[model samples]
Target: MKFTLLLFPLLALALRSQPRSRTGVTEHVTLNLRPGISLETTNAGAQDWIFQIVGKWSGFQDGHWGLELGDAPTAVYWFFNWDSVASHQEFTRSPEYPATIEKVESLASSFSAPHVPLQPFPPREVFASPVVSWVTFNLTGVANSTATTNWQATANDFLGNLTRVSGYRAHSSGWEVEDSRVFSVLVGWESAESLGAYVISRSFAEGFRRLVSGVAWEHRVLRVAGYVPKL
Candidate 1:
């Protein structure tokens, strides 16, 4: 009986190890909550809506955040994996889509809807208080080819160093499909405050500074709004 239990785990691992492919483009949404409104307050109402939507809807994998304090905008981000962008466009035309958009907008002071195309990378799941750091930067005077190299190298450095951090969760780096020179990095942390610690550490500071020295970058550190669906 004991050996059988062990074999079950091995069987499960073998199954997971088999070749598998995931399809879909990820959709990211951000909401800058209205003044005086807090994430805690928005979370309860958002959770209610998520439960309803996920129960009947398809395509949404997860929504996460990279929240910040001070004058920076507060945002909630969602990722959807659909077969094609056309499918997502069709989904927007659905009756439920407008109502869903309205509910989300009602919670924010302003939101972003720019059509920045992104190439999807394998998605990673993150738990805990998931603090995300979003960094978008423009290369300075560097050719596209050179910029691509820098981007890849920086991504490797950041992700490689992240593994040594105590609270690391998941990290994704991607280039803008329309303009490959523009890139974004999203790194997750276990707790809201954990990101701050990592950012101030010598390791992160040295690597980030070396990478962004000649570049103009915008970095936003945010708190993840808890809106996980049980289903």
Candidate 2:
């Protein structure tokens, strides 16, 4: 029995190896909480947290952040080809879950959703790519119509000239001036090579620099993730 048990792990390893796998499953998330709010201090802190699933949540580390912050946070998001909503449900339903009930109870006052649009990616013909996702968030102070249009036009001009890339699309969600001034964008690249080309390509750099000069904000960092669905 001992010898057979020892072989089980090896068999499992051999059956589940995929050398070609290089990305994590993509997920698009957006957060909007009423007119005046933030989650760092009150919600994420509590004494008895027994329900939110807090393991292995990095799904899209390979994408890029293209925009800037808003007045408050008109929105927050992550977009990529996720396995499915089923996987998220499974994690929440698991017996060992931690932040499930606790978050709801703690965040009852702060959380408000004018929209809960979680719809499947409709079967459509996109450029030659395995999967694609797009995320949107509000950069609180950037809701002004004039500056954003110019930025979009100028930035779009630069990206338009970036050669040798795939699955490129852009969407602008509104921002809340009370929280921030500019909104951020999440764009996906098919492979590392494509990402490299974009960075090294002078056409893209010149355009990005010009856009950056217009809006300056303190305390800025970017978060990226890569995702691949197993389904």
Best by lDDT: 1
Q: What do the candidate models score in CA lDDT, each in turn?
A: 0.55, 0.34
The TM-score of predicted model 1 comes to: 0.68
Q: Which residues of candidate 1, in runs, are more than 4 Å off?
A: 1-23, 65-74, 79-84, 113-122, 127-129, 177-179, 227-231
Clashes of each: 5, 49
Instruction: Provide the lDDT at 113 for model 2.
Output: 16
Q: Give one digit per residue, the lDDT tens place, for model 1 in 40-86.
A: 55455664584466435554444444345445445555443344344
TM-scores, each model vs. reference: 0.68, 0.35
In candidate 2 the C-alpha lDDT for residue 225 amounts to 23
> Which residue runs does candidate 2 get wrong by more than 4 Å?
1-145, 162-180, 217-231
* Pairs in steric clash, model 1: 66-222, 67-221, 67-222, 67-223, 68-222
- TM-score: which candidate is best? 1
In model 1, the Cα lDDT at residue 174 comes to 60
